[model samples]
Target: MAGFLLWLLLLVFCWPLALLALVLYPIVWLLLLPLRLVGITVSAVFAFLGALLMLPARMLRGRPV
Candidate 1:
């Protein structure tokens, strides 16, 4: 993948910073996990609201001739 290649390039160019990033990646992901879950929940709620709002219109549209 491109990310791995980029990281490899970084490792080749600067091992210390690359190692820091490698070590910090998991910690950063763990910190951001809750935000990601919230985003997914928000998106699902929005989708449910949209479907609920459109229900009547879909019901009235009925079958095509």
Candidate 2:
């Protein structure tokens, strides 16, 4: 992919920094994992609230004969 190509370019141009990034990537992802989970949870909660708010209107709309 583009990222791998970019990293390969970096490795050719500067191995040390590229290695540092390679090593740090997992640590950075681990640190950000909780934040990603929180974002997903927040989105789900908002969706549930939206559905709850719409329930009454949907109920009253009823089905056509």
Question: Which candidate should be chosen as best, given TM-score against the real structure?
Answer: 2
lDDT for model 1, please: 0.98
| Each prediction's whole-model lDDT (CA) | 0.98, 0.98
lDDT of 1 by residue, 1-65 (tens): 99999999999999999999999999999999999999999999999999999998898889564
TM-score of each: 0.90, 0.94
Q: In lDDT terms, how accurate is model 2?
A: 0.98
Model 1 TM-score on a 0 to 1 scale: 0.90
Model 2 clash pairs are none
Residue-wise C-alpha lDDT for candidate 2, range 1-65, written one tens digit per residue: 99999999999999999999999999999999999999999999999999999998898889564
CA deviation > 4 Å runs, candidate 2: 63-65
- Could you tell me the lDDT of residue 35 within candidate 1? 100
